[model samples]
Target: MAKDNRIQMLPAEWRASTTLSGVYALRMLGMFLVLPVLALYAAGLPGAADNKALVGLAMGMYGLTQALMQLPLGMASDRFGRKKVIYFGLIVFAAGSFMAAAADTLEMLVAARAVQGAGAVSAAVTALLADLTRDGVRTRAMSMVGLSIGLTFSVSLVLAPILTELVGVPGLFALTGVLTVISIGVVAWATPNPQISKLHEDAEAQPARMGEVLRDSRLLGYDFGIFALHASQMALFTALPFALVDLGWDKVQHWKVYLPATVIGLIAMVPLVIVGETRNKLKQVFLLGIACVAAAQIVLFAGLGSLWSIGLCLAVYFIGFNVLEASLPSMVSKTAPSDLKGTAMGVYNTMQSVGLFSGGAVGGLLFQHYGFSGVFGFCTALLLLWLLVAACAPAPQPVKNLGFAVPPAWQGRQEPLRQRLSAVAGIEAVRFSSDGQTVYIKALQEGFDQTAAEQIISGAN
Candidate 1:
């Protein structure tokens, strides 16, 4: 069969990717559905009065545990298998949801949320996708996962009020539990198993690379970028629904505000993202996004007196939020070494989880003591720091991720094969799995000679 150079996914790959991606979407949807209304619900719960700190903790408790356990879960998947770990996590997530549903006190709420966080399995999911995919199509597969999370966030925001109105917060929690439980069925029945497990350089995190991943300034830039972005988001949301209600928007009708803002924000994101990827202006786009997020927070703080003002600010905020959210992972993948890709992402996710925790924790603390200005100001400072991080970061190489099948004949002798493939001009990196079923490479320049590279891989050159 003649080799086709254009990027495409196998049918099985697409089925697995989309199904796993659905799992991500479902998880994110469960997490975010409460964001738009949690504050209001907490204030009404028993023992919530004057317990602002615990309430804050309740809001971000999931992040605290998620951050702490993310790597361990990834490593566990490496040992016990990805599906098993994911199933365990999902079960834990469902249990937490039910606990949250049963809680009537703020302290109980926080504990349930913490339990919810303990089910952190994001790295495992990514690792599984890596296990299932060839490097060439990994980015596309990852994007599907990323898009699911992003889209779910927007939909969750819009649905929060509706869900809250129909079922109340506890009922919503119950619904999430049901959703997560359903996903386990989807996983067992619909997801395909990988033929063999291998250490994918581009996907799974390695313990040994911890130092190198941490030390890289470029990776750190992406790290701080995600951290600040999510932190500001969590902080803004801690107060945003309350801010909306203060301006005469009904608590149950908040989705009216979120729908337009989320949609418009997403629409506004397209052009800049295109320019960043197509024009190779990623750094510029990244910095601009941080600035936009800060500016939106500032606007929200200043213009809280009007519903329209808050709506406008949300649109601005989501535009920046969506762009930063979409681009940061891409930057991480591009900046990380192939072997440390998983490790780099693990650290990145930890920062993100920390940001999630801090946003709620710190935002609530400040709001209790200093009012709304303090929370937004704190978030703004974080965004500014991310801006500086982006400014000083190393320029990322403009290369695309590619994967090729290593013919079975060469199987176990991939070491010598990598040695030969690495010698080819324009091939910046070459790596193979332990089983030698896949060959992953990064091209050095634009319009890389894929045909020439394949000839070398086929041992036909």
Candidate 2:
């Protein structure tokens, strides 16, 4: 295909990707809206007096529960159907939201948040995305979902202080519950169900592929990169709001700092990632990002006394954060066997949750005992370690996506067609479902020719 021809419009499945992602945004808004404001409000509650540690515990406990349940829920969706599992998860999330909304003390909030986290549905949502779209468009669709989450995080950060002042944490929880209910209706009524199949029986037959994924030196490096990235993120937030307070910025004006910085960070992140993936300099880009992260932590530690410094640190932090987030997923996709992509993502997400819980809990303790300097020190160390690990990871294979139209004869020759394609050189894997009328192939570089493959189909007919 010519360069111009290679660029395609966003496929139709993007609509469902956007809608499902909106549901995630709604859920996250409830969770993140309180992050900046929670510690301040907890001080006023009856049992929250001087126990900032407890506040930290409450903030991060949800992650622990979320981590534990992600994969199991996803596997369950395979058995019960995606929509059914999604609805069940949403109800669980709504119940947790209500519990948190009703809580009068810090301890109650902690328990309630755990319940909310327990409704882990990321895997289910992912499976739903896969079920609703063709494989060719699925990556782009997932990108939309990712974009939604990032945008939601930005919106929540800007809105959190203002919303917190007006309705408080409890009110935010109620709003989340209402949005979740709406999400249920959307899932049931609006989304179209795409056909599903076991496309990679060969990969499944070799159960050791999973062990390979787990033990793969390169993926492990990226896995550690994710854990460190999130851990630092959790630790930093433990003190960021208070640090800004000391610098004379009020809660409501937090958006003033966050909004422009987020824009700047996003602007810087996109180009670097494009270069990294297109040029095959993934490890280099990932390491550079970690270096920037460490620098941000250092800046945070050195300059807690001024608002300008805080803003600069935040700008640096977000730039690094956004780049790593985008690059990591692409790396995983490029490196993972197309067959076990879901399972690899499942494990990656679980690590992220583990980081979240650990970050909050460890950050709290560090702050309570060692103060702000300690939090920065902890986070800085994490970034440094991540940088080292990322530097050592093997480079990912260059990706070139191929799309093919099904031949008219494919109607009756599904198995034969697949068998013929499987024997072709350079083709790594093929998925052909007669009912779905689609074929997905992952190929080796410079081996398979699309025109030649097309001719074979024509001759077979």
Candidate 3:
């Protein structure tokens, strides 16, 4: 049979990806939904008035635990199986939700939130995503997951008021618990098992060299970008709720503002993103995003008390936030060595966890003492620092994606095959092993011919 080289969408895999992505997004949405209203809710809880610090701890400790446990859990998934790990995580998350729901005081809620953080399984979900997709379309598949999360953030903000209005804070936690349970059903019944791609890292692959990954400045740049992006997000949310309240909006109606800001931000972001990707100006785009974030912080610091002014600042902030959110992974993928993609992502996620924790923790303390201006000031300083780091960082070479198939007879002659594959036009990196060989050709994505290379490899064999 002739090999097809066309870049076609995966119709068959869409349903599973969509379902699983929704499940992942829903989990994240549960956490984010409370962001815009948590401050008000916390102020009302018994003992919350005495120690708002505990509330901050409760809010941010989840990220700390999440960062600590993510790698181990992901490794465990490799050993114990993805579904099993994910199921366990979901159960733990549900338990945390229930604990928070049943809490009589702020202290209990904090403990429950920390327990919820203990269930961090982002790496496992990502590993499963890679497991379920073919090499050629894996990035696009992953993008669907990214898109789901983005959509969830936007939708959760819009829905938070409505959900909170109907069920209140405790009910929101309960609803999240229920949603997680439903996702387990979706996982068991709907997701397909792709014949695992031996070409990519498997459950049992030896952990890649951390030293090498850490030393790669380019990868570190991408990691820093992720950290900064998430940190900014968490920090902004810490004060945004209170800021809205001071602007005369009630907690229940805050989503009215969120809905429009998010929508406008989403709309504004697409064009800038397209221009960056299409025009090969990703570095320029990234720096610009940092600048925008810094500017937004200034705007927020100056004008948060007025509803219209706050809206305007948010419009600016989300424009930067959304673009950077979409681009960071792509930057990571392009910068990371193909074999170490999993390891790089693991480290990147760890950085994100650190950011999430620090952002909320620091933002909370800043808010407690210095008011909203201090919170935005902190974000501004962080962004400026990040901008400097990114500005000095080296830009990545655009990698091309092309591959060759190994014929049956020469499966054992992998090293020589890698040598030959490397000689192919536009091929830049090659990884070949006895089990299933993969050739990562670096050329323009659209310019490479997958079929012709397959024929060449078959003929050579």
- What's the TM-score of each model vs. the native? 0.94, 0.87, 0.92
Candidate 1: clashing residue pairs, number: 4
- The candidate maximizing TM-score is 1
Error of 1 at 421 (Å): 4.3
- Residue range 328-443, candidate 1, lDDT tens digits: 88788777766567679888989999989998999889878877888888987888777777787776777665667777667888888888777776778876654567777766
| Worst-scoring 10-residue span by lDDT in model 2 | 198-207
Candidate 2 residue runs with Cα over 4 Å from true position: 1-14, 194-209, 400-440, 443-448, 453-461
RMSD of each candidate relative to the true structure: 2.2, 3.9, 2.7
Winner of 1 and 3 under lDDT: 1
Top-scoring candidate (lDDT)? 1
RMSD in angstroms, candidate 1? 2.2
Residue range with the least summed lDDT across 10 consecutive positions in model 1: 1-10
| lDDT (C-alpha, whole model) for all candidates | 0.83, 0.75, 0.74
Model 2 lDDT tens row, 93-141: 8999999889999899889889999888887787787666654566666
The order of the candidates by lDDT, greatest first, is 1, 2, 3
In candidate 1, which residue ranges exceed 4 Å CA deviation? 1-8, 408-425, 432-438
Candidate number that wins on lDDT, 1 or 2? 1
Per the 3 Å backbone cut-off, how many clashing residue pairs does candidate 2 have?
0
